[model samples]
Target: MFGLKESEIATLITAVSVEGGGDLDRVSIENRFARATWSGLAEPGDRLAGRAIQQLGAARALSAVVEHWNTERFAAELSADGDPVAGDDMRQAIDRWMPRLKSDTALIALRQAARFGARLLIPDDELWPERLNDLDWHAPSALWVRGTDAALAGIVDGIALVGARAATGYGEHITMEASAGLVDRGYTIVSGAAYGIDGMAHRAALASHGLTVAFLAGGVDRFYPSGHDSLLTRIVENGAVISELPCGSPPTKWRFLQRNRLIAAASLATIVLEAGWRSGSLNTAGHAAALGRPLGAVPGPVTSAASAGCHRLIRDYDAVCVTNPDQMAELAPLVEREIDVSEIDSELRISSATPGSEVSAENVDTVGARSPETTRLIDALSARSARTADDIAARSGLAITAVRAHLGLLELDGRVTETGRGWKRVAVAKPETSRVFRSPSTDSE
Candidate 1:
């Protein structure tokens, strides 16, 4: 009906239906086409478009826009069905939507997407991430994906690692470590396909034989950061490249900001490996925090200006200071529960021993119970020399406050002792020895 022959319409419908693995009836096919049209007509994160599709079906919503129905008529029609979008907002939305409407735009977008081997994913698709629904009215109208469906679904267990495009060597190194670590821990990596930290995260994850998804600001067919063309191609082979924009659409500044929300929403948590004070990666962190997702920041040297954003998040935004993959994985509750409970229980028991008492090999078996932060803090301390909190913080790449807190816990656990110089790690029993401890529970034995 939108300037397409019957055969053309059937082809478009079949393309979407086949990718979705569904048998589309007449109504379902029209609805799929309407959503595809909406993807082209509206910008990403357009709440009015989301609301329209949610209230009226996609087909009815497309017809209302294409038929040039005025706001008053549209409102009245929708209001009869108890829709809440009937006032000045609806009028403004129509104004914004009308100028972009073209009879052939959607059909061309569909053809271009097919040519690029991309699939159109609507909300009904099984591979569609249910987490995106958390965006509410800002969720994408549809996703244009160029990769495996399994890789797309892998995003549910993914961690978003993002940072400044002009990343420093320190930033890239930390990104590599965190990305590979998370992958080893059974989490997928998610990031925008930009240069710097994002590229490194994807590369590291792929090198570790893990899936990584890149969310683009432009069409999936047109990967941004032309330098990463080869990187994006590899991701498409092993993972996925996805976006809300249809084929032929170029990336814009506004789209890039909107795209950050998807990166934040799709992952279990968001970690800023390295960022500057005004880096765009901070926008993704903001979205993650707003969505109530766990947020982590890797601390960098205080002298490095590139890490100012991470410090800001640690000091001001309540973002946890994560120095390694073990810490990063803790940001996701699912991963945290899997990695923490048993280990922490074991550590707590070991730490509860009498102060100055020797820990046994049995206690050493529970060494994994220590948090990564605690481990790093201990590593920064020396048994022969006491160091100040600031020195330890600098060595550990942790916030001073965090270093002090860990020191306090270690002091109570007898793992460290406060001296006139500062603090020193206590010489716990070596793991090679099988020194036994007498306990009331074991007295009968």
Candidate 2:
């Protein structure tokens, strides 16, 4: 259906729209189909694609690709409209997207979603999680949600609870108490649906008969950690299981990292119950901090390694030290911070094309104009400790060859160091002005 009539597209899209898209006007139909197409074509957090959609609008952006517009042509079009994307970036983006541009892929995703009784929520939907807009170019194009609309809507008040998969009893207890307490306080529990703290958060939320959301790295159709299938099913029944990818996508290391951005942005704040230094939960916490979301971490026994990341957050970042549910609840935003965030983003956008742009943690890696792979690889590295290529590969979910290539390039740039043991990230000094990040709301079920 690459060149299908608008009506034809709507027929497929409406099948997965909320209440069969009572609001599916001609423009809405085209945008919905285009975004669903973009969602499947671009990986989550594909900044260039996000830029394309932001500048060109989803429908026209899709048409640009369909019309076989090359980088030069796309850049001219974007430049003429007052947004100039560096040519090399545009070339790389189009190169990656072209191979995945099967005419029927969006159609398949829409059809599969329809069969699965899932709804595709675009930014225009009333039920859309507006807070995610704070992510700007990193925002998801569309979300595939399998559950009640209430569950999706509840993200406004969502508070992400993330930590290690191998949680200690102390961690699980804290999570259970915090999640259930938050539920009692009229909040929706949000987590990634992983083991340990995440699972406990969802389970406690459900046990309390509170709403919960599980944002998946892959498609809603397939549950990751197959062990969590039944938990996910319950989440779908009592809350929602959501994903940015289309029906057939599988969870990978890269997608999981990108997926953390959604969890951090969608929630008003995030709490790290427990995590080791290298735990994936630290990635989520980083996203939360970058978003200027009020981050809190629970302190575990000082001797426990699982608590090291939480301790790191509290010590190194502005993360609040929250112990119980009562203290955790205080971290929620008192006012919507979207306007403040938008203003900071506007400044960054205006300043980005210039040299030496001052970037806050919110968009530090992105504002520097790094490649996505470089950004991911950098995120996978620890500045405090060296790691072998195999460890980096496992952490980044990148192939060993790809990891080595990135490492080599990074080493040349003096961004990482190779110790005899492994590699360590080179810590770069930030400008004094970058200390501030423009920083969000409540959810109900």
Candidate 3:
């Protein structure tokens, strides 16, 4: 752990992710290096390939062993010729695959975090959530933590609340109530820190002066959806904003989906207040179900599109249906506790607003280089599938020229790519059906 601050560790792992030298892919390599380093089996100077072989000598964790394999032609040539070093073929393979992570981006990012008072949390650490290991190789290398230890203390006793970005009135109400209730019951609320449900959950938790954690898809220092930057800052003041990615990492679509798994696994349970059939919240729920953890959804009206995902979970996936705080707590097997709601709400209102109009992708990047229109377009696109120039304009409520201009910017950024006729969000989920209102069938949206 020496000389390996959270950022340095991230850079080192990124260095190991060089691909195509052997059979190893960047993702697998990052996973292997993370496991080995945190397990105290590897150090910065040790020949990574050799350490990988040594770490896998037991053949116990097959996934770890398989990751270190090398498909280099040189190694194969040696093996085919019956070389003496064939006994150490795995080590030979590791050497053959050593040239991948020569880039300095990872290291630079690490330096930034160190300068910012941020720390990294790994699986073996006391703060690490054992549940995250359920993700196998897909689990994060380490969590970039920005906040007090208390924010992460009750991770095992937390619950995640996630839903649509353009949340309905009912959805917001449910998120606020659920967050407040859970906190009042002494449970930490974990969320993505996006707009709508995610924002409401964090705000409510803060209002109650309760522990809350925000798991970002980007770096600990980089808040995605720039609109929530201030909100995230507030959370980090008392709670935390964490990510598996290194500091200065951007919020790519793939990272968001990948991070959702962490949110689901880190908590004792997950709740969806409002989501459409294709919402990313479902992705988190899927991770929870795969881990065999208790899954819960607030039943929205069957007619309301935003409720589609929640309804699907209840009907098809057998998620526990909860309507209110009592029902939600019952699913978690908890006893009731009293709290001063007025004090928490009052404090939250006073501390919540920080003079930001909205959060957009322009500010989401660690670089803060994307424009506000580009952020708006991405936001609108993120809420739905491939949209035509006209469709984007209509849905985003922006001028046609503005939509076209933003779309062009997004395409150039590689955040979005053209899909056949129009354009589609790259590496991100298709947008969910928009919900204008909540129906009466469900008590709350």
The digit string of per-residue lDDT tens for model 2 on 1-445 reads 3587666678888788865777678888888889999898777888888888988899899999998998898988777767677998777677657656778888888888888888898887788899899899889999999998888878877889988887899999999999999999878999999878899999999999999999998889878767889999999998999999988776755676688889988987789899876567777877876676777889989999879878877766646788998888777733434335443323112122434432223432322355657755775687777888876664444456678888999999999999988999888885432221100000000
Query: Among these predicted structures, which one has the highest lDDT?
Result: 2
TM-score of every candidate relative to the true structure: 0.74, 0.78, 0.60
Candidate 1 lDDT, 51-109, residue by residue in tens: 78877778898889888888887777667656566578677677656656767777888
Candidate 3 per-residue lDDT over residues 1-445, each given as its tens digit: 2223544454544443222124544444444444433222211112333333333321222233335434453245334434324445445334322322223434565566666666656554567767676655345545677887888877766888988787899899998999999999888899988778999999999999999999876667767767788888899898988876666555644456556777878876678899876676777777765665567889887789878878877766667788887767655543311232122222211121334422111211221233434544564464235667765553333456566766777778777777666877666432223232111111010
> Where is model 1 more than 4 Å wrong at Cα?
16-22, 77-86, 335-445
- Judging by TM-score, tell me the better candidate of 1 and 3: 1
Candidate 2 lDDT at 19 equals 54
User: What is the overall TM-score of model 2 with all chains considered together?
Assistant: 0.78
Please tell me which predicted candidate would have the highest TM-score against the true structure: 2
- All candidates in order of TM-score, best leading: 2, 1, 3
lDDT of every model, 2 decimals: 0.76, 0.78, 0.60
Cα shift from native, residue 24, model 1 (Å): 1.6
